[model samples]
Target: MPGIHITDIEAAINFWRERRPSADGFTLALPVQALASLYARMVFQRQDLADEQAFSAAAWAAWQTWYASTPDTPCIAICSTSQGDAVCKGCGRTESEVQYWPEMGPAEKRSTWRRITAEGTAWRFNRYAERARETQRSNAGNS
Candidate 1:
């Protein structure tokens, strides 16, 4: 099983909610860095192509096929709950939401996804800001 890319996971979850089949399976139990390595390996495998433009075109086709087969969401938000937060920091979901995630109707689950996406974007921005600040401070000390 190939490690799951973030983009692939998104595509698979979206495709599942939309009731459409993706071109490939995106379910991977590996960590993000591992999945990134897999993606890098896949890109290298296509290095034999002589035509850059043709290769680019094929890459998109390949991605689409892979995205079609990925599995649905796996976020249970347990780590957050364990930290005493009633709602998941990742998905903004309550304990019930996490427990009922699998049994949820498509419409309800999609609504939950919207909240999850919103929270994820916010979390990403905050993380990026923190990293930038840390880098800046480290550079200041070195200069």
Candidate 2:
């Protein structure tokens, strides 16, 4: 069940839109249209995932384009799974995920990204986030 998540679909749509905005404002680029078609169908069927094997050639090409533009890994440099934690506090990845990430397929990696983002409890989303915000506030106060 290797599939693109709906959020990834939305990202792909945005990517295509930015790369090939409608010239006439009333039409879509072919890549956008192809991905959008799949997006619409997924929405109509209430599916959150687009089956990789089911993608049309055009849609597949479009998705690949978008996928290539994205970061390959979610690592934020900090790792906690190295210290016996089941999940890395930084990236929200399990120890196994950290260890095996380099060998994971695209879909598998994306799936992990989707899960971590949805959970939104990782240090990348919180601890580091708070630190960044504090720095921003401190800088603003200094200014």
Candidate 3:
């Protein structure tokens, strides 16, 4: 089973913190409390990943709630995986990821997103974005 990375937990914590900030500086929002408890345990245990099956009901529920708020995919509608690229130039997803995205779980999708975002090599983040503007400029100049 794919373990939940600590970074994902941290992101979820931040999400809940923003969505449900405590009225007082001392107290945590319910979802934040739930996820924070999990985060605390992970830190205390010195574990970088958490077992999904081991999650407490509240932790799982809190995580699910946070997950729902995140974007589902990183697709910029410029898929290069269609032309047989092992990794998509546009979205920065592996061909397997593109093929199986519909079936991937929230955690799996998030993991892919984390990797792609960290790499920052996707065309959508770089050249492909500039290329679109250039194309528009070319069209405007022609007319």
Best by lDDT: 2
Candidate 1 achieves a global lDDT of 0.48
Q: Against the unseen true structure, what C-alpha lDDT does each candidate score?
A: 0.48, 0.89, 0.86
Off by over 4 Å in 1: 1-71, 74-78, 119-143
Please report the TM-score between candidate 2 and the true structure. 0.87
- Evaluated at residue 126, the lDDT of candidate 2 is 92
- Candidate 3 TM-score over all chains jointly: 0.83
Off by over 4 Å in 2: 135-143
Candidates in descending TM-score order: 2, 3, 1
> For each candidate, C-alpha RMSD in Å?
15.4, 2.0, 4.2
Compare candidates 1 and 3 on TM-score and give the better one: 3
Error at 29, model 1, angstroms: 34
Between the candidate structures 2 and 3, which one is better when assessed by lDDT?
Answer: 2
Q: How do the predictions measure up, each by TM-score?
A: 0.34, 0.87, 0.83
lDDT of 3 by residue, 1-143 (tens): 56788888898889888988889888998778888898999999999878887578888998988788878888888888898889999899999999999999876887788789899999877987789899999999999
Q: Provide the lDDT at 25 for model 3.
A: 87
